[model samples]
Target chain A: MFSNDSQIGDFVKSAPKPKNEKERLAALKRLEILDTLPEQSYDDITKIASYVCQAPIALVSLIDGDRQWFKSRVGLDATETPRDIAFCAHAILEEELFYVPDSSKDERFADNPLVTGHPNVAFYAGAPLETAEGHRLGTLCVIDNKPRVFTDEQKDILTMLSRQVTQLLEYRVINENLKRETKIAKTMTRFFENSQDLMCVAGTDGFFKEVSPSFTEVLGYAVSELLGRPFLDFVHKDDIALTIKEVGKLAQGHRTVNFQNRYQTKDGRWLILSWTSSPSADGSTIYAIARDSTVEIQKQNELLKSYEEIKATRAELVRPKEEAIEASNAKSRFLANMSHELRTPMNAILGYSDLLIEEIDSSQPAVIEDVKKIKSAGDHLMRLINEILDLSKVEAGKMGVSRDTFKVAEVIGQVEGLVRSLIGKNQNKLAFDISKAPAAFNTDQEKYKQILINLISNSAKFTKSGNICVRVFEDNAAGVALMVTEISDSGIGIPTDKLESIFSEFSQVDESTTRLYGGTGLGLSICRKFADILGGKLSVKSELGKGSTFTLRLPSLAAKKSKSSSSQAPSKKGSKRAA
Target chain B: MKRVLVIEDNEINQDLIARRLVKKGYKVDFAIDGEKGLQLIESLQPDIVLLDMNLPVMDGWQVAEASKVNPKTKHIPIIALTAHAMAGDREKTLAAGCDEYQSKPIVFDELMKKIEKCLGSV
Candidate 1:
C-alpha cells in the first residue's frame, strides 16, 4: 500500500497486502501526514508503548509517497520504508485493530522481510491517530520479539491514548508560535529602554514622533513639549540649515553617518551633538541617536582659563625677585664709590699724623697735646672707614673665611690687645679671666679673632669705668664658650626692648645714642652676622649704668688635634702678651 | 716714559692719582667724562688709560668700549676704577673692555701693580 517506487524493493513487497486498492489509497491518506516534522508529544507515546509491551521496536508512523515514514520510534530508527512491504501501512488501512502474532509460525508471514528482517512482524499492533477534523494522521503502535496478546480493555485504552497523543502534538505547535512572539517583544523592549544615547523617530515633516527617555533626561525637556514639534525648532539657529540638509538626505533612504551640530536647550544654551540618522522604508520618518557634549565643552573652556591665569601669575611673581636683585646691586655700587672717596682722605690723615708724631717734641706740652688729638681723631676715622669696608665686603659676599687654625687662648689675647687702646682711652678697668682653653682648635682663626676684637671694642667704647673681663673656656656639651664682657660705670646700658633689634643693621637704642656715641651702628649687626656664619651665637646681658657682659660661644672638634700650626701661632702671641 | 690717561670727574681724586703717577715718571693726561676720555685716547694715544666707571655724559663702560674699538687708540690698555665692591662689577667692567678692575679708595700700591701689568702686557 505504501510503495509505487522500488527503492525499498522486495524486502517490503512480499509482506502483508492491502485487501483492496481503495483501502490502500485510503490507508495512505488516512495517516493524513506527509513531510511533517517530528514532535515529542507523539514520539514519547511511542517510547512508552514499546516499553510497556516489552517489544524491541515501536513506531508512530505516517505514510508518505513510497514508504511509511516514522514520526517517532523507540528501537527502529529508519524514517521511511518502501510502500509495497510496509506493515504499518496495512495496519493503518484497517478500521479494526491489527496484530501479527508469531510470524515465524504463520505461512503467509514466514517469508516476509517484516518477519525475517527489519520489522520482523513476530508481533504487532496499530491504532490510528485521528485529528480534530476526523482526519486520521498516524498511529501509536508497538512490536515485540515474541507474540503478544491484547485484551479488549487494553485495545480500547490504546486507541483512546493514541487519540489524546494527536491532540497534544497540535497544541504544542500553537504554543511554540506564541513563545516566539513573546521573546521578540521582550528583546525589542530591552533595546529601547537600555540604550544610553538619545534616540528618536521623526516624521517626514520634521516633527518628533517617538523619542527615548534619554532625550528628556539629557535636554531637560519632556515628551509632551517635544512631540509633534518641528525638530529644527530646538536646533541652534546656526545649525538649522545644516540639519535641514542632512534631514533631506535622510528622507532619500540614505543613512547620514556621524552628522554633528548643536541644538539649543530650553534654557537658551547650545549643546553640541553628534548623531547618525537612518531613513525608514516608508520614507516618512528618520531614526536617529545623538550624544550631548556640552559638559565636555565647558570643562575645556575652564581648563584654558586656569592655564591663562597661571601664566599671568607666573610673570607677576618673577618680576619682583629680579628687581630686588637689581636694587641690591645698585646699593653695592654706591658703597664702592663712596669708599673710594673716603679712603683717599683717610690715608692722608693717617699719613700726615705719622709724620707729625715724629716731628713734634713731647716735652713741648701744647704741641704734644695738639698732635695727640689729631692722631686720636685720625685713628677713630680710620676705624670707621674699616668698618664701612668690612660691612660692604660682607654684604657683597666677597669676604673669605681663613682656613688657618689657632688656639682659643690666642684669640682671647688678640681680642684683649685689640681693645686695650679702646679700654685705656675709655678709662675702663679691664680684667682677664681664663678658666680653661684647648691647647688649640681648628677653625678660620683670622675671622674668629676678628669677631672677638669687634665685640670687645664695641663693649669698651660703650663702657667708661668699672671693669672689663675676658673669659675663655671650652664646653664638651656642644663646642666652646668665649666670654669677653665689659662691667662698666659711666654709660646707660642697652634697653631690654632693643636687645634683638640691636642686632639688626643700622639699629641703635635711640637716635640720640647714635649722635652722642658717633657710631655707624653697624658694629653689633656685623658681629651677629659673623657669629651666625660661624654656627655660633653672640648674646648680651646688661644693667643700666652698672655694666654689660658680651659672650661668644663656639663649637669644638675632637679629632685631628695635632694642628701644630694653630698651636704655634697662638703660643707666640700668648707668650708675648702673658707679661 | 709710559703715558697714563686719568678719566675722573672728581678734581681731588684725579689730582691725587695723577700727581702720584707723574711723580713716578709717567706722562699723565686727563678727561672729565666718558666722551672726553674717548677724545683724549684718540689724540694722545696714551700707553695706559685709568678709567673711572662712573662719569657724566656716557659712563666709563661706554668710554672703555669706544676706546677699545677705535683703531687709532684701541692699542691702549685700560684699568677700570670703581668705587663699588659689588659682586659681578669686576666681571662687567672687564667685559666692557677694561683690561683690569680695581675698587677705590684706591690702594696706590695695588692700583700701580695692576697698571704695570696692563702696560707690560700691552
Candidate 2:
C-alpha cells in the first residue's frame, strides 16, 4: 500500500451509477466513436488534458456496454479495456470530476488490475464528457503511474478541455450528417437538370423561384432570363387568364394535374404544355412538371383544318350540280306546259276542220281539198309538239320505262300493221325476216314499239321504191343474250360524217333531209333515248347512197327502272299518244 | 234527245262543244263559268254535265263539289274535261267528284263514246 490521501477518500469509492444507463449508452453509440482511429482533433484534446493535469497517460474514451473504447490516447498502448476495470466508465456516471489519487492506497482501486498490473501505482483524474442533452457518454481523463494531486485551477482547466472534447464530438456528428445530406441533394439536383420535362418551383406571387435546365432548353430562354419573371408573362395572351386561374388553385393549396396551356417561347413560337403541379406544404410555392405538346396540338389543328376545307370544297362542288338539275327539271316542266297549250288549239283546228268538211258538199272538190289540207297541217303541228315533249323528258332524265313480257311476233305484227300504210305511201315493199326471233321477250313493250316505229317511219320517209327489211334476232355476245332488231332500207343513206350526229337531239342528216322528209328531226334521238332507258343501245350503219340499217339491241332481261323516273309513268292519253 | 250542259269559260271551246253535241242530236245548254254552271245544273237538269277545269271565276273542282252535294243534281253524270291534261289531272278531277274524265282539244270520238256510256248508265 501507498500513502493515504483525503482527496482519494473524497472521490467516490466505486464507479458512480447513473439512473439512465441504457440511455447513456445509447447516446454514446449515437456518436459512432467507439474504437475509432485516433483522429487529430480528439488526440489534440487528450494531449492538452494530459499536459494540464501533468499526467503520464491521457485518453478520449467512449464507454460502451461492457467496454471502454478509446477514440484517442497518449502514453497508452491499449485501445480498450473491460468496463468494470475502466476508470473512464466510472467517470461517465458522474456529473463532475472523478479522482483516484493513489490507487494502491484507495480502497476502490486497491485490488484493481490497473493498480497492480502493467503501468501500475496509478493516480487518476477524469472529467465526464456530456452531450448537450446532459447524457454523459464517456470522459476526457488523465492518469499517472505514481501518486499525484490536482489543484483547483488544473481541475477547472481539465473540465474546460473535456467540454472542448464534447464540442468536437458533436461537431463531427453534425458534420458527417451534413456531408451525407449534401450528397443526396447533389444527386437530386442532377436528376432535375438532366430530365427532359420542365421542372419548376414558383412562389405564390406567380414568379418562378427555381427552374430546371429543361425549362431553358424547351422555352429557348436562359435560366437567368426566366427566373424571377411571373410565369404568366411567358404564356400566350389568350391563355393568360386560364393560366392565372390554374395558378390560383395551386396557391390555395390545391394540386392540379395535366392542366394545359400555350406558352410563347423566346423565339416567338407557341409551345403547348401539359402541366402537373402541387403546392408546398406551407402553400408558399408550387412544384410543377410540364410536357411540351406543341407538335401534337399542331397536328390536331392541321387535321381539323383539312377536314373543314374538304367540307367546304364538297359544298362548292355540289351546288352547281344541284342547280343544273333544277334547271333541267324546269325546262321539262315548261315543255309539258307548252305541249298542253299547243294541243288545245290543235284539237280545235283538227276537230273543226273535220266538222267543216262534213258540213260541206262532196261535189265541190276545191273546198273539200282545202279543208283536208288544214286538217293535215294541224296534225303535223301536233306531231311536232309531241316530239318536242318526248325529247325534253329524255333530256331531263324523267323518261319512264314500263316493263312487260310480250310476244315477239305480236309486237312485230303490230309494228307492221301500223307501218303498212306508211310503207305503201312510199311505194316500198316491206319484208319481215324473223327466223331467229325468240318466242317471247321481257322488256318495256311501249319503248320497244316506239323504237321500231321510229326506225320504220324513218326508212319509209327516205325510200320510195326499195324493199325495207326488218330482221329480228337474238345475239348472244359477252355471255348475255340481247334481242337485236335490225331495220335495213335501200333508201337515201346517211353520210358517214352525219351518222353520229343523227342520234343527237333535233339532228337530221342534213337540212335537205328535214325539208324533203317533212318529219321532226327528234325521231332517231328519241328512239336512242328510249333504247337507253330500257338498258339497250340503238346504232346505225349507213353508206352515202346505197342503203342504211338501224339496229336496236336490248338486254334479254328487263332492267329495273332508274330511281329518278321510277315514280313517273310514261305519259298516256297525251300529245305523246298522238305521235 | 239527251240533254247536255257544257261548262266552259273559253268562248271557242264552248261553241265547239255546243256545235258538236247539237250535231249529234243532243239538246245542249251553256254556262260561261263554274258559278253559272252550278246554277244551270238545277235549271236545265241535263242528262249529263261537261265540266271544264281551269275556268275563270269558279274552277271545275268547286263546281263539281257544289253540284254533287245537291240532291237534285247529284244523280246527273258529270264528266271532267280539262286542257290541263298532265298525268295526275284525271285522278285529281275524278277525286273532285266527276263521274268521268276527258282531256281537251277533245278527241270528239272518244268524247262521244264517254258521253254515250254516261247517258246509257242512267
Each model's DockQ score: 0.06, 0.20
Worst 10 residues of 2 chain A by lDDT: A3-12
lDDT of 1 by residue, B21-91 (tens): 88689998889998988899998888988999989998999999988888887888999998654435776
The alpha-carbon deviation from the true structure for residue A461 of candidate 1, after best TM-score superposition, in angstroms, is: 2.5
Tens digits of per-residue lDDT for model 1, A210-253: 88887787777888888957888889888989988888888888
- How much of the true contact map at the interface does candidate 2 reproduce, as a fraction? 0.16
Clash pairs of candidate 2? Answer: none
Q: What's model 1's TM-score?
A: 0.48
**Model 1 chain B poorest 10 in a row by lDDT:** B83-92
Query: Model 2, DockQ value?
Result: 0.20
**lDDT score of residue A198 within candidate 2:** 95
**Model 2 per-residue lDDT tens digits across residues B1-122:** 88999998877788888888898999998898989999999988999999998887899999999999999999999999987544356667888899999986687888999999998898
Regions of model 1 farther than 4 Å from truth = A1-187, A190-197, A200-210, A213-262, A270-399, A407-420, A433-435, A479-491, A556-579, B1-122
